[model samples]
Target chain A: MPLDIPLIGARTALWLVAQIHLFLAAFVLGAPIFIVISEWLGLQTRDPRYERLARETMKVVAIAYSLTAVFGVLFAFVLMGPYQLLTNYLFRALYPVWALYGLFILLETVCMYLYWYTWGPLSATTVRKWMHIGIGVVLNVLGTIVMLLMNAVAGFMNTPPKAIETATLWELVNNAAWWPLNLHRFLGNITFGGFVVALFAAFMFLTSRTGEDRKFYDWMGYIGNLIGVGALMTMPLAGYVLAKELFLYDAQLATFMMADKLSGYFVMQGLLVVLLFLGANFYMWLSMQRIEGGPRFAPHMKAVFGVLLAGGVIWVVPQNFFPDLLSKAPPGVSEQALILPERFAFLGLMVAKALAVTAIIIMTFVTYLLYRRARATGRIVWGRIDPMAQYVLIFIPAVAVYLMGLMGAIRSLTRMDYHVYGALKDLTPYWYVVTLGHSSVMAAITTVSFFLLLVFVFWVGFVMGKAHE
Target chain B: MSDPGTDPREARIEAVPLTPGAKGGWRRVKGPGIFALAGLAAIWVLLPMVSDSWGIRFGAPYRVFFSLAVLGSALFFILLNWGPIPAPGSPLTTFASIFLVYGATVGGVMSFGLWYYPQFEIPKPAVEQARAQERGKQAFLSPAANCFACHSIEALGIRGGTRGPDLSAVGAQAEARKSGTPAEDYIRESIVNPAACLTPLPASGLAECLPAADPARTYPPLMPPGFKDRLSDEQINDLVTFLMGLKGLAEQDGKSR
Candidate 1:
């Protein structure tokens, strides 16, 4: 049955809830992987700094775990209510997978609470420390399984096997886009977790009073940024593989995504990604200032900046002025002129854009190498970074959040006018793909809402810690 | 007392003894090496731009070459600068540096957008028709319509799937398919209502026109019957226009074939 809520409508309501749930879920899943790494590093190097960072970040994750669950339940309610038909069909089709997802969630929850609560107790002995790390390893395993289980459903919805009705459960789980989406989301979670951690560290660094606190937070921010940026470098390649798989599954769907309905949305995505690269690079350059011998390579860094800018320009150029390929140039404006000229048409092709993306990634790596070299030559004075660097650190996560929301919208909208793509059509009044402008506004809202809630999560951690103290 | 120009924190700078092996030997060639690499990349980029103006097609190979050259230059620059320099600057200079990179990024994207925007002038009628034909070609190739999949226009170098007869000369063939039928009317009927245009066979006793090609070979009724519902009126019209413009091969080419 067709359904609509009063003011916001069912689709928008579901979008908001799903986006929030996904943001929190990503943090919930992503934080443990890195937190465990930090814990292990502390044990290896016997650095109290790593342990403190891990324990502090775990507090935020512990609090966010509940928020993720609340939103997940709310998301379910939205799906089962207005989107009853779709929910029912999906449940009937893959109840086993859903059950497995549930089981994993329970295991993950138990492991997470244990790992967080036992940090202090477990550090008393090396054997216990390893045991705590073992718990973390189990938690990460459960989280990854949960993510993959969910990806199967999403990937199947986008690209159902040709004989879907009679297809075995194995076939359903191993759809063309399943593994690619799994890899993409896996890398994305790490990147997301890293940036969010960095954002937290930046906030702490900005508000820190004592030099020691500032120094600790500064070091934490650097590690977070490094992990985030390092993971980010591989995301585009993963994304490319995912897109290729989707295209291979259904040429029309891919065309709809890249050349038709969602074309302009990608241009906006390009802008966000450009902001992320520029912001990350800018932070690194500013960070170099804290290194004794960093300033000598300033000119080289400036040249790299130019290359990144040029690549950004290429990546954002649209093949046509209008978002939709079928759209005509406005009256009095020649269509020929609106279209990319023949000589420059090659710039709009995938080859050129791919090359541009490669250049951007390479330049980012170069900047990181320069920073490392500078460090090796002299010493890095922690807590000496410019305040602007902290602001840039904060900016990167905001852009990352926005990018995630936009990409999620694109992925869902690729099934345009259908609930399960070609298998089950959407019969609602709001079946059409929304305009790029509308989607961008929705993504902006999601980004703001996510950050506001994240601030709450951080505050809860802080308040609870104070109470314990 | 610390100098007023310097940060007070600089007074606490930790000194690290540099390894003697990592001294200034590499710095002598680093600057010149990076310069040479950057110059090579610039030349690769400029070559295509200059060659394109002279009507030379560098094609995919040259494009890939230039892309790699740019990447190589960046990599070389990083490798050469693997050493030490000076300290952090004042807050003002740092802020300026941050803004400069961001400002350039924004300005670059906006400038490219503006450069790509069309001039506000109407195209001539021929240009309009050409645009329509282009749109029609896109629709034909589009996955939604997928007309190119079953129909090959060998004259246009399209080797379509072997589900239907070659339509390289459909414009001329359509007019000759039936008596007292206009080419446009027949083609439109064939698309929106495929059943109406089925080829008649003496044995099967159907009542449509003869096959466009060989008398014994008849196309199966495999064309979609819902183009009217699937495509907009303008799209169908554009497809028709694009197909109508496809004349048969030149006399010599036809004879050779």
Candidate 2:
């Protein structure tokens, strides 16, 4: 259908709603998984701290979960309004899957409320708490199922299977890009969830008035970072699989993503990943100062950081640094300046980036192992964590949000003019491929807006809960 | 002002019974019911009028359903959370609430279908596609793509090079080259990766074929490998879509042979 909306153009509206919805959805999906895990850990260890953390986090989940549904509904509207015909085509092809997704959403909502509201009542006894944990598990399972169904739809759009017009539902959902995206997003959600949780903990830690408050928040922040970094470490492997599949599905699309016009995004992606690892490792290193024998691992930190720095530099090097090789140079004096050889530029290639990122991933794990050793060898000195560490917690989530937004834009925009890859062309007035600078700017704005909105949500929840108290 | 020993949250929890009476249950359901009904009514009545007034083109009914679905889900959650729904929450009501949301969503979608039944048609022709493909063909000839600079299309009769394979029937050849590779994909790959999977000689000899080996070692890789660098993503897609249409010439040649 030809789209002509009066005020906000269809594409811009969809882009905003879709990104916001995804961020909220990721929070909803992630919060449940962590809440359940934390609950199980508490039960296993008999630590009241874990139990309290789980309870408090679930409260956040209940609030965020409602917002997720709210944004999801908005996203659906945005999809139908501007991109009706394309939506119809996909709807007809995958309506059964969509129906199942709706069913799971319903189940997830029910389970989320039950899990939240019944925390005390359901866990009155050890036997009952196990059952409560079981319910929490059910909530996460249903949430994941919903996410998978949605991923299949999104995956189909990016790498639409051949003859999608006549493809069966099974074939449609099983498109080349589906499983890779599923795996990536599955792990990615947990990582996203951890950062947001850590961000929450950091805010609490910074604002805490008492020693008890400070200590509790510090512990919570540490746990959040632990889960977040653990998940973040494996992300590169999942990313590689997705990128490889993208290349296999369509070289042109892959080339655009990695080697050409959109290459800058990949570079940005590399930098963000490096930052995530650095932030996580740096936080761990700072935490070591609180442990008696933590100083022993300090020397090794230099080597790991060196590797990470080298990798980060290599990974983010733009593939095409000399876009204007000759003509755009100063009219007279470019011969000597342009003499830098092509062989040195080879480091900017995909292979080099891959190698560098792999090195970063390994070093990150080494740093984690060092942190583990420090904990084993010496008692945690505890209390009086540097304030800068709290800022790192804040930085981690902000960068995570920004990185997610940028990646989402890259994924959708790679479709270019096609509503579905290579078919169902986007015939709207706003079908032009957005420039990299423009896309990057929009991504930054979406990210900042998301953070602002998330803070507002937390504030509202805090005020409302205070009123109830 | 507050009791030091008493926790307000626990006090509130203890104040509400875990199970409510029949009347209380109905009251809880009523809160969400009113919200859902109000939203459904707005969607049913006001959406079309809004679409008209603002002149929002394209699928107003569908858009209305979507708007309704979002509002209904949100309202359902808010009501479930805040309204006098059961004490501590009920599984039975939770199940029912789920169905309620699903029913509303399904009804919203189906109602849009009912309202705009005439708009639903099968097999709408993609007329704009032809023009896009035509532009793509021009791009192939233009200096940006320069497909004709080295590779010739016998069907179009612009044989200018012996460097690359003849693309006269590259479309059909592309499909037949790999068992499952689509013509569009094969064509796209060839543009972006000139040497990889070079087309084999058609057993029927209807078109010029590559050496099936190193055109790279012999020539200076004349098939400029990075069209992705030069052409916009849309342009590349158009070029691929255009090349996929080259199957006709191969079919005609096979028939002639």
**Per-model DockQ against the true two-chain complex:** 0.03, 0.01
Q: Which stretches of candidate 2 lie over 4 Å from their true place?
A: A1-8, A322-340, A463-468, B1-257
| Clashing pairs for predicted structure model 2, backbone only | none
User: After best superposition, candidate 1 residue B21: deviation in angstroms?
Assistant: 38
lDDT per residue as tens, model 1, A97-146: 99999998999899988988898899899999999999999999999999
Candidate 2: which docking quality band? incorrect
C-alpha positional error of residue A236 in candidate 2 after TM-score superposition, expressed in Å: 1.2
TM-score of predicted chain B versus true chain B for each candidate: 0.44, 0.44
Winning model by DockQ = 1
Taking all chains together, each candidate's TM-score versus the true structure is 0.68, 0.64
All candidates: TM-score of chain A = 0.98, 0.94
Predicted complex 1: CAPRI docking category: incorrect
Report the poorest 10 consecutive residues by lDDT, candidate 2 chain A: A321-330
lDDT of 2: 0.67
